[model samples]
Target: MILYTPLANTDIFPADNAVFTKRHCVSYQNKQFFVEETDKGDFQVLQLLSTDPQDFLRQEFNPGTIIKEH
Candidate 1:
């Protein structure tokens, strides 16, 4: 089944302990994910995926196959 997630241009969590950003995103089975927003929110939202200190970030490898990271 295909699922769609709604996103916003606002921060869902508070920033602390270091530089923080609010990303409007949705995950596909916690594997492949994507963040959506207007032009203004693109940098802050999409950039979070490939930002520095990449420990807390993830990637969506494909659009099929039991939702596993390639």
Candidate 2:
């Protein structure tokens, strides 16, 4: 099949279910984020799902940033 898009391959064809267990889609400050669970029981920002370009400029949503769940 031919897929024409800018998304990464992994985003199109996902891997095993086990790989998704560590990841989660969370909503914070009215923004959606894909985060991964860290060993310290914190959520590490993986990707920001937003249409606003300004959201990307925010430091908090940057990948690799860690967040603690309340």
Candidate 3:
């Protein structure tokens, strides 16, 4: 089946409530990041919410990169 709506996929088919529980908004390096808790107790970068373009260029903030707590 094809979906033609301009709305986002999540908006069309809402995600599981448990999925949101794993996600968190964290501040790292003075930047806000949307991260998800991993099985290893590390946070994985989901989305980078920053106004600076340079933040996007940083590999550390890239999606899928795991952020381990020191």
Candidate 4:
């Protein structure tokens, strides 16, 4: 089996109205990505990376569950 590492903390995700927060997003290699909202709800995803995280990054708050990174 082959395991892949995610490029987290990289300047790949973009911030937009769709995104709840648009605070600290940077640009690199002429690419942009964002934590997007899909029909399935919110997902912390990259711009165009086929690689999936080894495991999901999630957190629990008073409101409920929030995926910190995935």
Candidate 5:
């Protein structure tokens, strides 16, 4: 499984350094990804937890779950 965080903007802002307090879990083709909206109201991928399709089918995989990098 590959984890990826998509960049919303190339230009860095001071606020970008701030931790994301609110985030949403999204699934595409059974892959789960974490996304949060920036101050600019643009959606950005905070983290990508799993790329495995079967992982998304698990009961533990739900929305509003906090994902962190190890």
Candidate 6:
């Protein structure tokens, strides 16, 4: 899946066999982030997986997140 967050200008492409479960977490730039798959075949960055200090602030891309087509 190609998931993008405009606020962060970040794109995440999961592998073909990448399994996305409620417990799945992605580590980007040393910070962990959660993933949630929507009913429409899009994914959501649920929230920051860690509560510790990080270089960047975590942005929430709730309902209006966009899916990019390749």
**Error at 41, model 2, angstroms:** 1.7
Q: What is the lDDT of residue 9 in candidate 1?
A: 25
lDDT of 3 by residue, 1-70 (tens): 9978889998677777788889999988888999999988999999999889988999989999999876
Q: Write the per-residue lDDT of candidate 2 for residues 1-70, one digit (tens) a residue.
A: 7989999998878886777799999988888999999878899999999999999999988999998885
What lDDT score goes with residue 10 in model 5?
38
Winner by TM-score: 3
Q: What is the lDDT of every predicted structure here?
A: 0.35, 0.90, 0.90, 0.35, 0.55, 0.49
Residue-level lDDT of model 4, residues 1-70, one tens digit each, is 5545575533345454445553233232332333344445444344332233422332221122222432
- Using TM-score, rank the candidates from best to worst: 3, 2, 6, 5, 4, 1
If scored against the real structure, what TM-score would every candidate get? 0.17, 0.72, 0.79, 0.18, 0.32, 0.34
Cα lDDT tens digits, model 1, 1-70, are 5445474324444346233333334554432234443334332223233234443433433222122223
**Consecutive 10-residue window with the lowest summed lDDT within model 5:** 61-70
The Cα error of candidate 1 at residue 42, in Å, is 12
For every candidate structure, what is the RMSD over all alpha carbons to the true structure, in angstroms? 15.1, 2.7, 3.6, 14.0, 11.1, 14.5
Over 4 Å off, model 6: 1-23, 38-43, 53-70
Q: Which stretches of candidate 3 lie over 4 Å from their true place?
A: 1-5, 8-15
lDDT of 6 by residue, 1-70 (tens): 6655664432344553445453345554565656666566555565655666552343443323332211
What would the per-residue lDDT of candidate 5 be over residues 1-70, giving only the tens digit for each residue? 5545575443333355445454566664456677775555544555557857677566544553333331
Candidate 4: deviation at residue 17, Å?
10
Candidate 3 displacement at residue 26 in angstroms? 0.3
Positional deviation of residue 69's Cα in model 1 after best superposition, in angstroms: 19
Q: What's model 3's TM-score? A: 0.79
By lDDT, is 2 or 4 better? 2
On the 0 to 100 scale, the lDDT of residue 66 in model 3 is 93
Clashing pairs in 3: none
